[model samples]
Target: MTTSSYLTVKALTKYIKRKFDADPHLREVYVKGELSNVKIHSSGHIYFTLKDDAARITAAMFRTQASKLKFKPEEGMQVYIRGEVNVYESSGIYQLYVQTMEPDGVGGLFVAFNQLKERLQKEGFFNPNFKQPIPKFPNTVGVLTATTGAAIRDICTTINRRYPLAEIVIYPTVVQGENAAPNIVKNIQLANNQQLCDVLIVGRGGGSIEDLWAFNEEIVAQAIFESRIPIISAVGHETDTTIADFVADLRAPTPTAAAELAVPNQHELIQRIISNKSRLQQMTSALVQFERSRLKKLQNAYPLATPERLYRPFIEKIVQLDMQLGRASQMYLMKKYNALQKLDSTIKSHSPKNEIQYNYKQINHMTDLLTRSVLSLLQKKKDQYGANVRTLEALNPLSIMTRGYSVTYKEQQVVKSVTQLSKDEEIDIHFHDGKVQAKIIEIHEGGEK
Candidate 1:
């Protein structure tokens, strides 16, 4: 018989690893159990045990998977883990590898809180619209918390130290446990209804999730949201968050911080007021100096200093004008007088008495010569007139009538020859003295020959 060679341990382990990797159901599984013997390694791996009341199985979470846990896994903590059940192959032992884990009971509560937060945010309950501004100088501060807790004492001490004048009104209520949410909401409403303070601080000291759960209640959140007064939420430490923190107008990291935010320091406020008063005094002094200088300048002005000095130039100008007017009137009178004197001299030199005497002598001599010339011209004219008259008388037609001559007319026209007269025609006869109408009694062909 031929003897087969035995597989080495390394080869057997490799074969087991291969079988584990090939089995999909063995590679991945989820286990729910209470955790035990929990140990965190320097490399961030977690070694623990997952067991029921009767049985137990070893579990390991590598650094990469362990780092993702929201809450630290402690001994006796119940959790749900998702990972693989695989053989280590070196030790020939099978163990569960945890890839993900969540706190068995708290995880559901966390999920519910997140869902509500998202819903409230979407509905604008946490919007800036609902956020009241903190009073700059709160005279009275209202605190809503357990009357016996350290949170209230811390707040009162901080407020007293920073602003002594501030009056603290404590609205005592339970800050934790089952009845805490209703008490908190009622006290917040009472504070607002009383209008007893300028600002409100609603919070308590830090604690675990279960202890801090009252602040995360919806009733507490709604009370904070409906507050007319500004509210500062200081429920827990910086790492702890509550619904009140989201719904409050402002959030402070601790109870002492909330008190600091509530009131102003009296010393700093007094310093600022003093600084402002000093500035006002300085401005007043400068204004008074400016006005005084202006008044002095007005007093130094010539018109205000001496009224007569302002009118001196006008008086001098009027006097000069009067002197010029006097000189002009005198010059005009002298010119008129000179013109009249020349007229008087010209009249005396050419008098009408002298002119009349010279005219009389010239007239007497001219009259004698004119008389002789007139007599000679008259004699010449008379002789010419007689000769013209005789020439006219010789050519007159009436001379023929004076010598027994007459004229005969036919049809009112003179008949110079016998042939011109017509037989039995009306005729007219004209002598030197008168004319007579007639008719031809016979016809004569020729002049009597």
Candidate 2:
């Protein structure tokens, strides 16, 4: 090969780029392999190797395409990458510039993510109703993450910069692997039980799904759900999402973003409070001014404010009251005078002297008539009384005895009938002249005429 006859490195690279762009098959291709030696760039680009047991290829994804990847490609993660295969003459290396990538054969991280997502969702951890709203102005913020991670540093720095008034309480926790989940869960529960914070930030820096799996654990999700205080989940970069995100009261895309969300900017809040206070003072002053103006208007319109204006009306009312009182008194006196005149006329017509003489004359006539009639009635009553007395005296037994009549009595009773006498019945006989002892004679039946 003659080096002078061949193209230079830049020329060859340009030619290869043109060739790859022109060839549709080479421009859009699909490849499957396991990822290795992955290095993520600050510019968001990713460089790695795609290898199998038999072959390997150097791969690259620019920031745009790398940002679209759902799962992080690591040293041993299987993935399917779609991109153009091209030659880079600078390093004389043949590589794949990936456009899109997905897990190869359903990566373990993806499977775990889906499985945990479904399980937590089934357990109601992702229910919107269970979410607690983050406090707008948190007094204290509890952070559950590694003490050494950049996540806690970034969060603390951002919170201190934005809201210096809020207390930053770090519940240091392991943020990866098996022990990470239990530590995270314990910190969350401890934060809640202690009531140390008004809001909680459970998060860590971005990592592969395996590195971030602690946030996806059922225990961590349950701990977040059971927290009485609101939780903001910030586990990864903007594109990175986790089960903790869905179950959290609020999901911030990054730890810095979560810090920005956790509390208001102190300067802005103080400005707003001052503005409101000024507005309230202004409104109160305006209200007082309005009331004062109204009072002034009322005072100007009131008769008491101008006492001379009331004199004519007051004098007119007094004159009218005097006329009414005069008319009422005249009417009262005239009524009394007429009543007295009528009484005097009645007294003249029925004087006591004439009434007494007339009454006396009527009483004298009635007395004479009553005396004559009473004397006649008394003589009749006296004659009747004497006749009744004489009859009563004649019918008396004593009177009969005095007339030579006698009555016989037995057992102190007069025997007026023969049935009253019984044979051999001893009895005392009582005659008109005296009493004697007697016995009943036999053979007396009914021979009396």
* Candidate achieving the largest TM-score: 2
Alpha-carbon TM-score of each model against the true structure: 0.46, 0.47
Candidate 1, 1-449: lDDT as tens digits: 43457778878888888889899998779889998999999999999999998999998999998765545677887888899988887688779999888878778457546766877788787999779999998889999888887899999999999899989999988988778999998998899889989999999898887788888777888888988999999988988888888999999999999999999877888999999999999999999999999999999997998989889999999999999999999999999999999999998888889779999999999998999999999999999999999998987889868898898877767787877766788888898889898888887565543
Worst 10 residues of 2 by lDDT: 66-75
Q: What does the lDDT come to for candidate 1?
A: 0.88
**Candidate 2 structure quality by residue, lDDT tens digits, 1-449:** 88789898788878877877688898889998998999999999999999999999999999998765545566787887789888877786779999888886776467667867876788788888878777888889999888997899999999999998899999889998768988988888888789989999989999887788778776788888888989999998998898889989999999999999999998898899999999999999999999999889888886868877889898999999999999999999999999999999998887699789999999999999999999999999999999999999977888777777677777888777788888988777666779779787673668854
The regions of model 2 sitting more than 4 angstroms off are: 1-104, 304-449
Candidate lDDT scores, in order, read: 0.88, 0.86
